[model samples]
Target: MWDSLVLGTKPYKRYYEASLLTRYIPANSTVVTSNTDSEDLRSAVFKTADGEYTILLEAKAGTDKEVTFDFGGEPPVGKTFYKHVYQADVQLEGNAVIPSASGSFSTGAGSSFTDSDIDAEHNVIVYTTLPPQTQVEVTPLEPVVTAGQAQQLAASVIDNTGGVTWSVIGSGNGAVTAEGLYTAPAVDEEKLVAVKASSVQDPDSYGIALIRVQPAPAAGRADIPQFSLEYGKYAFTEALTITTATEGAEIRYTTDGSAPTLSSTLYTGPIFLTTGTKKITAAAFKGGLEPSANVFRLYKIGNVSAGPDGYDFLAYDGAEELSFTGTASIAYGADGLFFYKTLTGPVSTAGLFEDPNPASDDKRYYISTLIQDEEPAVTIYNAGFEMPVTSAYLTGPITNGWAFDYRSGVQKNGSAFAAAVAPQGTQTAFMISRSGITGELIQDINFREGEYELSFRMASRPSYGDILPFQVYFDDQLLGTYQPNPSGSFALVTTEGFTASAGYHTLRFSGIETPQESTVFIDDVRIRPKGSPPLPENPQPNPLPEEPELGPPLEELSNEGFEAPVLAAHRKGPFTESWYFNGYAGVHPNGSAFQPPPAPEGNQTAFLQSVSGGQGLIRQHLEFKEGTYNLTFQAAKRSTSGGRDHSFKVFVDDTQIGSFTTASTAFQPFVTESFTVSAGAHTIRFVGAAATQEATSFIDDVNLNRLDASE
Candidate 1:
């Protein structure tokens, strides 16, 4: 490699140092020709790993000679090159001697440099064209300054002298002193001023600080208008009222979906809304003060009717196609409304509400009549693969509404090589087939007996031309088998109308194994009535409504009290009957080994112990109706040696909805946020961890119940 040697001592005659070569020429550097024609000089060029070139020149023991050295390529114009000269005439201090003369020169035209005065007799000259590396940072990057106020700023330069020159950018905005003191202009209007600090050593390097200048507060603005009724769909005509908290403010409103101004219609009383959708924009204003910010609300007015066939339909228009009699509650969805009511006969007009806007051919309404405690259609949970927010890929047993088998999980689009962007959301479900094993994702859906169609988006990894084979199945019947085009983009695939009975049916997607491993991405899976409009293309789901009052516990989960396969006092074991346990988690009876409070429901409780810096998790799958429900449980921290506070997380499928931490030795009841599940199977998981090993959390008496109308 690029290394040199020299020998001698005392007067350092003909002395050569190995450290000199290793210091300038790095290991593995290639030695190249310097292209110099001079009998009095010996030269070598080296190319470092970072593409930097270093030149070494030695003048023989003779008269001084001028030499011209050529670099391979032309150096950047005005680029500085450092030069270090070690002369035999200079006195050596110790084993490590400093260079006799050190300076730098900039390239003016070409990459060649001619040294006019090169001392002879054991002279070493090292030349490198590496640019000076410097970083300038300004303190108080963003500061709020009052009009005419001064703020002190500082500049810090790394790898160079700390001296800097401060200057302001905005004209007539502000000024900065040489000492980095910034003063805002004496103006009433708010403005932003940029203060720059340039490095004294490197003029090209600098940092800027933004200063916000605003006038002092004078008076508060009027309060914005508020509506008594919340926005969204309504089944009947409604009266809306606008109000403001500002004492002497006047409310102005607009009904044509335009911004409300001072000259808009004045609000005197409640406004009545009949049919069709309306957008109300309102604002408040008071004399001698600024007008309040405008508030906007959108309301879709529709009508509900009951047909003679015992089915109810909610229509967007006033057209009365069916007779009305019974009272029904309304629920809102992404594209339409659901009229839920009890009926005596089988549903024959369930499809009537499918198309609410006949003129536009928009299917906006749906009828979910309760026939023998069963509804025709239910919502789908996590249908867009948007749960368990992840940045790259996540795989485990807690996928919320979906379960994975083998090499199947959710992944963020564009996170890995060849992964394409999801067609609907930021994440998609991926199934891989490798080693003659097919990866699958399964979800059990509760659908009423009706004709339905299944649809989803599918794509293959980008640049991977292999045909990804996949199949969709409902229960034991295969709906369709597909081999997506290798275009690397998603395409919507829909199955023909299929009949489904009212009960829990396993819906599965399988990536078929082939000679070559393959991967298939699935997103936005949907199942709708045979002819119903496809869920609004790439629709954003509506936020869940406030949970209603819980009526009674639904016997949906097994071993809620952790009493099955009971263990003896002071004993613990993996006795989970209807639940899945991961890490150091299982059921344990109240014992003295780990002092725990009395069981909230039974003699035994589920326990999760953190060990080896790992968290413990317990999860169970349960079926739920399409409504809001409450989840209640009791948790306590185990009193034991090396135990600390326990932290717990609750998840419905892949989304973590709530979490809590417990340090109390006695059991405490905890009611989590309402979980609104579509009528289907969903996984409920609890993950617990503590700072120290052997820390355990005791959980018991977990219950979930659907809320009723009466709070």
Candidate 2:
């Protein structure tokens, strides 16, 4: 058999073929009586090592012959015989030239097969019944375990009377006991480990389970140190204290601006700031824990100076005692020059600061006693809301020269709601109204008791309209009711001239809420003599909406009532089909925010809101024959608070045909000025505008109809 398979080629194929017979037949098997009926056939039977008989038959090259093998009653009745036939084909190439084998099954006391007219071939038929298969199944196919933890597993054996052996598949993955108990490796990193169970009866049959091992959690670090005094300029001495929140943690500090280290001075008591500026850095440390992040502060002591040109410069460092009224308090220490107020009712809070340096300057008396008289001028410190510089969205009472009431504070420009750039600096003071309660920013100044006007750059929140009107006050008297333009950009507003008493008087900008909530932004506030040249009024208005001329009309705006793009819920988009929307404009179902009024023609309406302080627009293009046309639509304000300032402009092509305000929550019809267009295509656009954030407009049933020549 070996020589026939080798066929003058490498012995690898011969060895492979021999192993197949020895694997199942066994070399010690004994031959038994086996014979074939045809003269051209030969057969022999052998008893396998497993006590079963196997028959081998050989066919000679000749005419087609049907051969039968006689088992002589040795094989059991109803026994299934497995037949394998091997034949050679010259047409095959490479490894394919080797004789190919085919298999089939037959059952009975005797087996018969037909051989076609071809080259001689051998057939091996086995009558032995196969033993039941041995299968091993590992329980918990996948498990998650923590590092250094142990998990117990189980293996079940089926169809065989044998047990299983347990083993690990990867090095350093983990270890497993013979009883299937797995212990995960003690690691700091996560890994996957495979545990396997192999059947002893059938070693080739095995089961595997994967385990995910997670690393242990880490320890926490020490807390950073806190300073007793806020970092800023001061005119007097200060006692500074440094402490940490971590229990039993020691604080190390450096006063020379260098980072604190373990070798730095241990903080035990308060450090005295007698004069000059000092930069302090501190960090906290505890046993067996990482050092905390460093905290730094700069304190300038005795740094107050006289202003040039007979002007007295004054600064509030939050340490001075000031008269505070209502619900207000000054925050000192690390919070740094902040005044806080809590609104419980309709009352307001304020703080008063009198001029500390009201005396005139005199020349050196050694020469000639000469006292110079200069024009009386009072400068408001931190007038631009630039003090307490911070990147935070909102900071407080701003004790650096101003006081706040209720929802009023200093806000970083562009931090909340994508506002326009500040008129003068990176920060602006803001007052908000909620639940009919308004906010105020107050500062007491020692005016020369003359006619004065208040000037400040004011803007409405971009997302909401300027629904809340604000007033300027000289003490308890109102100067004027100022309404911010719907445009989000800041505009220099100068209040009407008002008279003030000579002593210290309060300058307050208070908000007046009209049935809803709103917010106003104030920056660069100044109280100057009435005729003082008004701050150059260079208001930066929001750029006009760009309406690109679209291609000729695509089906004449089929969804005029916004009935298409039907949404199961409210959604924002640049919808398609007949209309195109830019920015925060989309179709909304009736009864939705801003669409409270039933749509004029359908259950849905189109809504638009300002986009990042700019106008939100929706437009459609249509071809028009040279003639006069009238455009009309239904508009309504959003049904929510702060929605009163909603308005929109209608444009035919590039020309603004009309501007309309949606002051009422109910849908109202609006007609644009009749327009004449040349034959061709033109665009109709509705641009939304608001004076405050959260303002929205709803529109529906838009139509453009040609007027009859007779009219």
Candidate 3:
């Protein structure tokens, strides 16, 4: 029996042919049945002469009484077959035999018989070659990818041809090229993508890699705008166009000095601005993207106003009305007030009388000012501190019609009314002592239901490296606070727009003295009518909303860096549980006693430097339900007086946990520690360890994160 197996290769192909023409017959006998064991042929491994290539082959029944060998699917090239084929029941011209023999063939070498014989019955076997066993190894077993991003992939075969074909398993998942570069789809939905790499040498063998698709890129907030014209005044008309670089972005704009929102007017064409000054602000918006930064432009189309030097004003004194006519002038009575007048033309004035009533018909006064002044008014009794103090220092609360209240000390300080320092015509002025104490100086004044301006002269002597601060209150309502600058002469301090009803009201100068030794002097405390003094600018709107009423201090703690820098170390100020620094015994870090350390996370860090050897303490109040939380903070230490290690103990409420210490001046790595706070309000504090010498300890960036109860 004769059977033929063909394995052909193209001219330029790198593989050789895998064809064999086999002539198997009984030794020296006529051709008959050619039966072979199918199992043996199927399990045979075919290889080349040099064993460089291997393939698996299967044996099957061929037509016309012959056995055929099948290479799994297609005949693999670049190899020869040398495996033995089992023969059974061989018949040559009516003779049968039960023996088996081996046969061989090569694609380039041709078929060959193992032995030659004649006139004998014997089994004939054929050589078998196996198809190459190929496996593909893909790089990056699993990878995370974002939508619309491309990733390069690689595949290699183990002990076989390295060639591989790449493809994606499903539709709309993404696209992959033959070279293994995959490009994800534009959709943001996350999905798992299966990429396959099939071996070219073995069709049935492949490798799969899972690509984890992540969400789309984030659309961040927009950028601020750029203006074509510089911000300044111009005489001629100018055309302005609002533009943003973001593609397909729409610009919403406002020309009325209001913030621009999505519902504002959409900008399409250039804005033709003429005449008056206008403020143009614009913001960009796009679908699926965050709005761009806002751009602001102020265009002054006409002449811009200047400071006080811009105009001339005629000056007149009290009870003196000799004025050659002009539109604007300054009238000096008990005070100096700006007055504007409009007339047919410039002319000499008749005797002008000043009106102090809100509903007055004074022709010389501006109608607005005259109408505002029409309300009844009164002057404070002994407006200036001209009364003599009963003694060198105030021994009691009441003296010279003024009452004093101190935290713990007597009302004692130098008098501004003394002959040496008092201004030329002054006789007596009150000096309030500020020596580590809290106090208030007050007086009662009867007002007739009118708005008034309180003006005074204040001076202070430098003390404790800080200016002493004082607050003014009217009828228990805080009006303003004052910090008198240490000048050689007195500076004027004034507060306006103080309205009073028809009754007696208490005015006060209250203060909590600093650790420094300072004194506040008061003279010429005058209260006058505020008859429409050009109507002070509108009060600024509060940037922060009013905090909700929190029961039992449930509000979260804020301002980790002591908002009051003076609270650092042992220096005194108002210390609250939210933030306070004090020391006892011996633990103190050495640095500035009052100032914070250099380069803090925020404006300042609570720097506890050992001035006198004692334990330094810093505390914060926190309220929480029963829960576990992570406490994190950054700490730093330095040597100021001695090289004593700056160590501090951490505590939740009053119970101490572990301690932290660093000897270098640089800040330590941010550390996190866990602590459980039982239900209710608690305090987290850091106390410096007691040391004999000075060392500096710093703390900043304190945060607490709640954890799950099960964790």
Candidate 4:
């Protein structure tokens, strides 16, 4: 063996060996020995006498060829091949097949090969790119390539792989083929290839055909096949086998027009489509591959399961397209109602429900129900009062009346008229008792319905004893008139129908003395078919359906702090009577307007409810810069004798929040009052009283509102 056998090679790879095979052996001797095949140079294996075990020969080639590999953990888009390639070299003690010589070559076949001779041998990696113009003819080459060959994809054995290596063997974001094989690297529309055949010593180097991988033309798929479904396929047995230019690919069938995802099983066979002209569509694809769509129309009978006896799971859009398409199935065990539904129209009528044989558990049928709702009750509004019921008989004396005589009907118990239920006290008044100090008598009566009759010998002694003609009033309205017999005997003013209807009503009596003698006196009073008169005006009115409103004004609570802030004081009380908020309210507990200091954070402005209510001129003054204020008291009645009514005069310095209205004698609940104060605590009071007639009145619910000054 001689070093001259090999030449022009440096930067050799390091190695360890059992014994030197090239130990100066004779050039003529057969210096070859069976080696582990992976050993890089298999130095000239020749042993000398005495077994020194040394031989010399050709120098080894450069380091092994560097194969750049790449791949994506995705399926192959193009018809890339994979084949398992095991290293073919003489195995060294450590199995390290350091290449004897290697250098990249950009010229001459795009490969680095050793000079070839009878005994020349070499290997090296070089890239060969399939240009954009290279035509690809995907021939199922190797007629017998797939026969029980530990079958691996052609992409595996990319020995001396020249094109893109997305990754080296067994590495990086890459995917193995279904056949358990990996391809070279993934290149963008670039084609790298592996060779099935190459010369032995041609560096054992391989070359790939330069054909651009055009993302493997997406296999054109046959439309979702419309089946001539026959009895052989009683249960829709056809695979709906969508034939595509691709094999081993999957079809995502959407028989219900629903989107098919990875979770949807592959369309291996026909699916029993649901009722209504079935529309079956399929999207075919390989992993990370573009999708091809196929749509097919077919009729599937609702055979396996009994659908609505009259319809084929009714069609919603229209009854014209009711049929079972093979994508969905009306299988025997399926549960649920399949009819088209709508809110407004009759999807299923009452009669359509097959009696569900409620008597037995096994019996099943279709049934539906109807829902009806009641409308809201109507609210009523009437300015006039209301009397719910009517009935009664006569009962009572004819006292409480005024004879309209200055001598007897004076504001002090002077009687000229009579009344049934008028204000009986205070400055305001009602029925008078007597007239002229003589005997001017009056009669009180009730109406059959909302009306009343009055029969009295009324006489007016206007001046000392001067009698003047007078009239009677029914509930403040003047009725008929009558004259007086000085003796005041029975002067009938009503024989019958005189009292219109039955209800609580007022009757006034009056007449002229006609220069009369003794005071007039009347008698024989009667009232019947009575009805409790409606109280004055009813408050709440019926509101329009769409125009509801909560009109009460709201006030800020507990407002405090300083600088300046807006403040609205609120006051609540019986809407019926007027209130007097005398400054006395300010001094006493019932009218307390307490002010508190500001909170620390109040850098902003602060204000108070400078407003108030009082008698004649009273109110919650804006105690900006405080000072003492005076006050008075007044709970006096303002009604006529035998009657009662009250009104309050509230003034805020001069503004009034206290309004006044007379409280009628008709049945009514006592009311409450309230008000809002500024950003501080405050005390408030309620004055109570009544006239010389009935009992006194009282005010309650004296509340005050305050707010935080800052916010």
The C-alpha RMSD of each candidate to the native structure, in angstroms, is: 29.9, 37.6, 40.3, 47.8
**Which digits, one per residue and each the tens of the lDDT, describe model 3 over residues 1-711?**
211101001111111111121222112332222334643334323333433322233334442224343333333443464533333232221011112223344554333222221112232234434432355767775666778899898887753665888999989999999899999876533456889988887767787777766556445744444455644455434446566667788887775557778877666654544434567777878877777655565665532111011121222222133322212222312211223333321334454434533342321222110112222134343344433222233433433445645431121123322322433112234334445565566767656677887766666655324445788888878878887776635676668568888667888877646775555655556566774343222212111111122225536767654433321122221123356544221111112222224535543466554322345656666677788886677767653333346777888876776677867666665544677777878877677674433456667667777876553
Candidates 3 and 4, the one with greater lDDT: 3
Off by over 4 Å in 4: 1-528, 531-572, 575-684, 693-711
| Evaluation by TM-score, superior candidate among 2 and 3 | 2
Top-down lDDT ranking: 1, 2, 3, 4
Top TM-score prediction, candidate number: 2
lDDT of 2 by residue, 587-685 (tens): 766434233677778667888775225567788887777889888889887765334457778898789999888888888999999998888778888
Q: Best by lDDT, which number?
A: 1
Whole-model Cα lDDT per candidate?
0.63, 0.61, 0.49, 0.27
Where is model 3 poorest over a 10-residue stretch in terms of lDDT?
A: 5-14
Q: Comparing 2 and 3 by lDDT, which wins?
A: 2
Query: For model 4, how does the per-residue alpha-carbon lDDT over 621-663 read when each residue is reduced to its tens digit?
Result: 2222122222222122212122345444333332333544345
**Candidates, ranked, TM-score:** 2, 1, 3, 4
Model 4 gets an lDDT of 0.27
Q: Least accurate stretch of 10 residues (summed lDDT) in model 4? A: 380-389
User: Model 2, 236: alpha-carbon shift in Å?
Assistant: 9.2
